[model samples]
Target: MAVESYKKIETYKASDVKTKVVDTDVLIIGGGMSGCGAAYEAAYWAKAANKKVVLVEKAAIERSGAVAHGLSAINCYLGLSGRSQFTNNKPITLEEFARYVTLDMMGVSREDLVVDYARNVDDSVHLFEKWGLPIWKDENGKYVREGRWQIMINGESYKPIVAEAAKKAIGEENIYERVFITHLLLDKDDKNKVAGAVGFSVRDPIFYVFKAKAVIIATGGATGLFRPKSTGEGMGRIWYAVFNTGSGYSMAIEAGAHTTQMEHRFIPTRFKDGYGPVGAWFLLFKSRATNAYGKDYTENVAAIEKYKPYANASPVPTPLRNHQMIEEIVQGRGPIYMRTEEALQKLSAGDPKNAKKLLEDAWEDFLDMTIDQALLWAATNTEPDKAPS
Candidate 1:
């Protein structure tokens, strides 16, 4: 059944490959935020049990996954310092957080999981601040708020700080960087149980077989699976991490793990071409996205009604907001723009003396997170006060 084109011109014997076996009490795949957090927590319990924890990363943990480049804000933080317009100016409670998540996800979210995350996310944020990540604070020393649940941060070194702590906790000897896990190894007697994993090094021809008592796959999302707008050389310029190819999902599915919502994917709107983050502009700066006619199309009741109750939800669901924008383009109001100049001018008007500082803050938003956006601005000689992004 094999095609002639699929045949290799040259082949090597199996003996030509090198294999190494590693045994650990817990095996963690991927080195993104989730993997690093898992390793940090697992190390404590692992050490107490006198067990070994091994983490394998396809790339270096210091600058890997979604947070590799950096971030301008901690998008999730439910602490006493947290303040949100959606929360009615009070600290967000566990129940409220869970409700918000459930609503935002269109009731597709697990309430128990959402509550658990809400309860502990603040501690992690505090830990990040304690670990030398500068969280922006107001004059009263309260953490600056950026929309609901988000806090401003000078996060150029966010991953490095988290990765350093995780490395220290897990120990340098246990980490296997540059090792890409190909698949999970199931127990021979019970095929449903995961016994270990198999991978190979990116640097060498050596193959790795890890025999873990338990395996944790935190390999982030399955980006690049769908066709991207940018093709060829610019193909890698996507909103999400390009390296995340759903290897974990594939491995788990192959081992008989059940899954749902496989067809559903979160599509976010970003700055045109550069794929720059629009969060800071929308949430922090309170910028409005308008159609080519300079109309705030999000206010279009007709479009919002199509998505029903989800569109009417507090803060409005991300998908619904994107839907309105897409509807605009489909309706011939193409080339939608974020009212950046209007937002900047309004913010500067409030603090006329600090206009220059405000401009720096706007630029820093892109610089700290998506450097490409800043580079794009530089290339185009963009002035935020003069034009929209």
Candidate 2:
């Protein structure tokens, strides 16, 4: 008798769950990098065309998504010309950039997309600056280059900057924060087209259903699909944003969209134990990687052929570098090290103004993107001297 009464009460509570309805011309599912971009454009265009726009985010847009911690550098910038002197000044054409990208993916990358990204990346970055993103610029009044096609930036508060811009484009009321979208709604007559989506508030039990003419899903990349090197209690250790749990992929799959490139995993060879940012060492400081015998294995490796024409590109393709590092390890030349002394000495002895600017920029990079790791470095008096695990 008591069990039956409890079951009836549970059913009653379930039936009492709240459901909220929203209608808009355009509904965006995720609020990460891609989602924010889509929402910003959608809202802008919708306003121009006199249409309603809605943005649904799983968390607060201010500190939500992958770039919440901030970014140290902007990759794929056209910085070959106009900028003069911290050191090397070389021109990088789109073709050279495309070639390097192709080599990085081992020829599996979408070259067309690469070219398109290269062309538009700078404009988008500049727009971010216009919206209050503090990009580091040199005394010459040009954006400071961290490496070829890369520029240093203080992007710690980038999320809020972009989110505020989005809100301004679309009314603040149109944007929904802390809404975890569960599934997309399909058109009744034509199942192929997405009608809208349904979600629930992260903080409350209120269920949300959005009805719209179009939907966009941009929840960033997937992580935690496969186990990392760390096992047991630390198995969750991973480099990518942990929040991106293949939600975008799953949503697309349910919508009958074909997903590809599952085999291509970007397994980065990073620092052991902590898995700190590796790009900072080489890209910002111009550190070189040497094997056990202090031999520069990167130049002699077969992978070097991939970036043949642009062999000396300031920052080479990540995958190509990782591949070379792994080869050295497998060949019994196990230990590898980032030779930073030469770069450090140069930085210490170089033009005071340029050196000060470089260190400040690099320090800000560590503080924003990887504060915890930066703290670890400070506590232990360590640098990127050891080989990547």
| Candidate 2 local lDDT, 316-357, one digit each (tens) | 566767778878887878577656556665666767777666
Model 1 misplaced regions, further than 4 Å:
1-14, 80-88, 260-264, 350-352
Q: How close is candidate 2 to the true structure, as a TM-score?
A: 0.83
* Residue 37 lDDT (model 1): 91
The CA lDDT at 249 in model 2 is: 77
lDDT of 1 by residue, 236-306 (tens): 78878888888888988988888866655677766577686778888888898888898998888788786
> lDDT of candidate 2?
0.74
Candidate 1 accuracy as TM-score: 0.92
Q: Please list all clashing residue pairs in model 2, or write none if there are none.
A: none
Top-lDDT structure, candidate number:
1
Pairs of residues at least 3 apart in sequence or in different chains that clash in candidate 1:
none
